[model samples]
Target: MVKTIITLLMMIILFLGGTLFGIDQASEGIIQTRGYATADVKEAVQPSRDEAGNVEVELLGKDLQQVTFEEKEQEFQEIESSNFTQKLAGSMEKGVSSFYNLMIQSVYQLVQVFF
Candidate 1:
């Protein structure tokens, strides 16, 4: 019947569309993947106050810290107890989360065809 044909067509179209465009569903959700991701870096100027009472921002034009990842998953409590890399990563988490949220939202809006 026409209904069955339409259903089959939709299924085929969605399957093809998913293969071409819906990698997000095929992969883990954005939030979950974000947990495994390393933080993005931006060159920035951070203020440093000298002993002689001069305060000025120094430009750090390089990636301030490189991510030295160990395969072990770092936990909140462990970050405080562990070495420099863990602490630095914990500190960067907030900014990275915000950045990811903004980027994903923007892309979602741009790609949304249902509206």
Candidate 2:
């Protein structure tokens, strides 16, 4: 009986080890495929700093340009204004919950009035 238990335990350990190794390999393959899909494997270039240690960002490329703080704020506001789906979803959730609460309250009030 002891020998049988030992053999069974060894088989269980081997099976678990193989399962974990397969899982690791599968996850590695997924990560590699994701990296390939993004095509952004190169290391990112760090922003150059000035003598006073102030962070200086140099925007390269033709389409990029440095904007004022007001411009950035306006851009953020525009993005927020354009997010209609998020606002709609939030309002729908609120309406559904409010309706559910109203139904429960009406039931409770009816029971109190009757009994």
> CA lDDT of 9 in candidate 2?
100
TM-score of each predicted structure versus truth: 0.23, 0.43
State candidate 1's TM-score.
Answer: 0.23
Query: Which residue segments of model 1 deviate by more than 4 Å?
Result: 1-82
TM-score of 2: 0.43
lDDT of each: 0.69, 0.81
lDDT of 2 at 25: 95
lDDT of 1 by residue, 1-97 (tens): 9999999999999999888676856455664765643255343667666677666565765323322255334555476576888668877998899
Off by over 4 Å in 2: 1-8, 23-72, 108-115
Candidate 2, 1-115: lDDT as tens digits: 9999999999999999999999999988987876753365543434665676666554442233346799999999999999999999999999999999999999999999999
- Give per-model CA RMSD: 23.6, 6.6
Which structure among the candidates has the greatest lDDT? Answer: 2
Lowest summed lDDT across 10 adjacent residues in model 1 is found at 62-71
- Structure candidate 2, residue pairs in collision: none
